[model samples]
Target: MSCSIKPVYGAQHPPLQVMPKGKEERSKTSNKRDAFQDFENNTSDAWDDGDDDLLVMANIQMSLRDVRSTAQAVMENHSKQLSAQNQQTSSVKDELRKLSWSGIPKPVRATAWKILSGYLPASLDRREPTLQRKRHEYFGFIEQYYDTRHQEIHQDTFRQQHLGLGTILKDIPRMTSLAHLFQQKVVQEIFERILYIWAIRHPASGYVQGINDLVTPFFVVFLSEFIDNDVESENFDLCQLPQETLNIIEADSFWCTSRLLDGIQDNYTFAQPGIQMKVNALKELIKRIDVPLYKHLEEHCVEFLQFSFRWMNNILMREIPLRCTIRLWDTYQAEQNGFADFHLYVCAAFLVRFTQDVLREQDFQGILMFLQNLPTHHWQNEEIGELLAEAYKLKFMFADAPNHLSKKK
Candidate 1:
C-alpha cells in the first residue's frame, strides 16, 4: 500500500513553533517580578530618586498582580468547565471533547478517559454498574485464560503464551525504567499480568513489542485514583493497597488498553499495513504542510519509515516522556477515531515541529539521528498542549480533503 504524493496548490502554512523552554515557569508572578526588578536595576539611573520612581515601581507591581489574577481566573474557568461536564447525568461528550481537546484536569482524568475511550457509558446512571460488570468480566478472563498458560497439553497455546510473556517481560522494565512506580515489584507483576492477558485474548496481533507501553498511561491514570501523590515520580508502596483495589486498577487498565487497541489494531497485525499506510500518510502530510523539510529528507534519501515507524507503532510512547504521553492521549481519546485518524496529523505536526532542524541537517544520517534522539525528555503538559494545538490545526486543514493525500495518477 504505497502512498503517492500529490502537489499541494495553496500557500504553505507557517512552520510549526516549539513553545519556549520554561514558558510556563516564566509566566509565574515570582518570575515576572524578578524580571521586572532586573529591568528596574538595569535602568535605575534613568529614573529620578524621588516620588516618581516610587510611583513607577508601584504601577509595575500592580500590573504583575493583574497578570497573576488573569492567569488564575483562566485556570479556574477551565476547572469549572471540566467539573460541570463530568457531573452531568446525560452525555456531555461534545463538551468533554471541546474541553479535553486542550487538556483534561487531572482530578477527573480517569473518569473522563474511561468515558472518552468508550469503556464507560456517557450516562452517569449506567457508569457504576457498567464498571462493576466490566471489571468482573475481566477478572473472569483471568480465571479462565490466564491459568491455561502453563497447561502443556495444549503445546501450541503454551508456546504462544511463553513467547508473549517473554517479550512482555523484556519490554515492561524498559518501558518506564526511571518511573518510581514502575520500579516497584508489585507494579511490575501487575503490568505483566495485564500484558499477558491482553496478548492471549487478542490472538490476531498477539503481543507486539510496543503494546506494553500502551498500558502504562491507563495504569498510571487509574492508579492515581487510589494514591495521593504523583504516580510518575513519587515512590509509593503498592503493597499498602488492598488486593481488591489492585485488582480494580489492573482490570481497568486492561479493558481501557483493549478499547484503545481496538481502534488501531491493524498497526500491529501482519505486516502492520495500518502503520505503513499511516507513515506514508504522515509523509504526504508533511509534503503539504512543510515542503522544505520534506524536500530536505528527499535530497538526503531519508525515508519516512526509518524514523516514523516507531511514531505510528507506539503512538509516540517511545518518543516523549511518560507524563507527556499521558497528556497527549487526553486529546487522542477526545477526538473521533483519534488514535487512527488524528494521530496522522499529530505525527505530521510533530515532524514539522522540527522543520528548522530538519532543514539544517545536510546529510541522511544527521537528519535521522536528530529525529530519533529528539530532546523531549523535559517536555511537560504545556509543551504537549502546544503540540496538540498544531495537530488540530493540521487536521482542520487537510483531514477532509482526502484527495490531498490520495494516490497520484
Candidate 2:
C-alpha cells in the first residue's frame, strides 16, 4: 500500500481542523492557513490527542443480550455465597471468563481487572487491606527511588506529554478539553514517579514511550473505582480529590501496569526483541491470512517494521480511539495470555483492514503512509466489535501458528 501523501515525519494522522461556515470561517481562514503552515514546518501538533475519541462513545455496539443479562453475575455470586465468598470462586471465575468476551461494565471493571491480572489476593476479604498496604509501599518507594531523580522524572514526563505544559495546551486539545487539572505539576509527578520507579526496578526493560500511554488507561479506570458516577460524562476536579485517593490510584496503576508488563517484558527489553518477533510474526501471519496484501506490501518494498512497530508498540491505542481500547482490553485482560498472544491477532486484523486500498497503492512511500495513517477516522463502537471478531477468528485459526515465532526476521 503505497501513498502519494508525501513523506511527513511523525504525522500520526491527518489535520483535524473542522471547517466552519461563512463570516467566521472567512475571518479564521488566514489564521488557519498560518497554523497549518506551522504544522507543516514542525509536525508536533499532528499527534492524535484523543479528543476525536469521544464521538465514538455512542457507537459501541457490544452485544447486550448475553452481556446485559450477565451484567451483575459476579456480584450476585459474591452476595449469595457471602459466608464462604472465596469458595464459590470457581463458578464466579467461570462466569467472568464467559462474560468478559463481550465486555465488562464500567462499575465492575476495576475489580474484574484486578482479579484477572493476578494482582488481587485470593482471599476476597483481604483486597482492601492489601490495596492499602501496596499503595503505602508505592508512595514509600517514590521517596526511596525518585527522590534523587525528581527533576529527571519531571522533564521526562513532560517531554512524554508533547514537550511541556504550554505545548500540551497549545497543541493537544484532548488534554485541555479533559480539564486544566491534568496539566498541573504535581499531577505530572505522580505519573512520572510511578513510571520512573518501575523502569529503575525493572532494569531489563526500562521506560518506553508507549508505556506511558499504557498507564493512562489503568490510571483512569482505577481512578474510576473511587468515584461512583460516570467518569466520562462528569467533570471531576483532580485538585479536589483527596491525596490518599490519588496515592491509591497512582500505586494501583503502577502495580497493575507492572503485572501487565511482566507478561510482555520482552517488548521493552534489550533492543525490543518482543516487537521484532511480533513484527516478523505479524508478517508471517498476514501472509497466511491475506496473501494479496502481503504480496502488495512486499512489492512496494515496505518492511513489516515500517508501520507495524506503531501497531505493536501502542497496542492499537494509536490506531483505535480510547473508548474502543478499553472495551478491547476488557477481553484482553480476561484471558491469561491475552495481551501477549491475542494482541498479535489484533495487529493482524488491523493490518489487513485496508487491503483493497493498500493493494491499490502504487509506491513504497504511499504504502508506508497508508499503513501509518490507517483509515480509522470514522470508526465507532460497531467497527471495533467487528475488528475484535476478526482478531478472534485469526487467533482461532492460527495458534502458535506463525511457526515458533521466528527469531531471524
Q: Local distance difference test, per candidate?
A: 0.82, 0.73
Winning candidate number (lDDT) = 1
lDDT of 1 by residue, 1-409 (tens): 9997654322232223245668745555355555555555556655556635654565464578888998999999999987886677334777788788778888999999998888998987888999999999988888887766676643476475445566777788888645677778888889888887887777777778888888989988898898886453346678989999999999999999999999999998878899999988988888887888888999999999999999998889889988888899988988899999999988888888888988888988899999998988899988888898898888888888889987667
lDDT of 2 by residue, 16-104 (tens): 44456775467565654454544555664654565435334334566878676677787777777885765576566667777887788
Name the top TM-score candidate.
Answer: 1
TM-score of 2: 0.69
- Model 1 error, position 333 (Å): 0.8
User: Candidate 1 — which residues are off by over 4 angstroms?
Assistant: 1-91, 153-155, 158-162, 177-179, 230-234
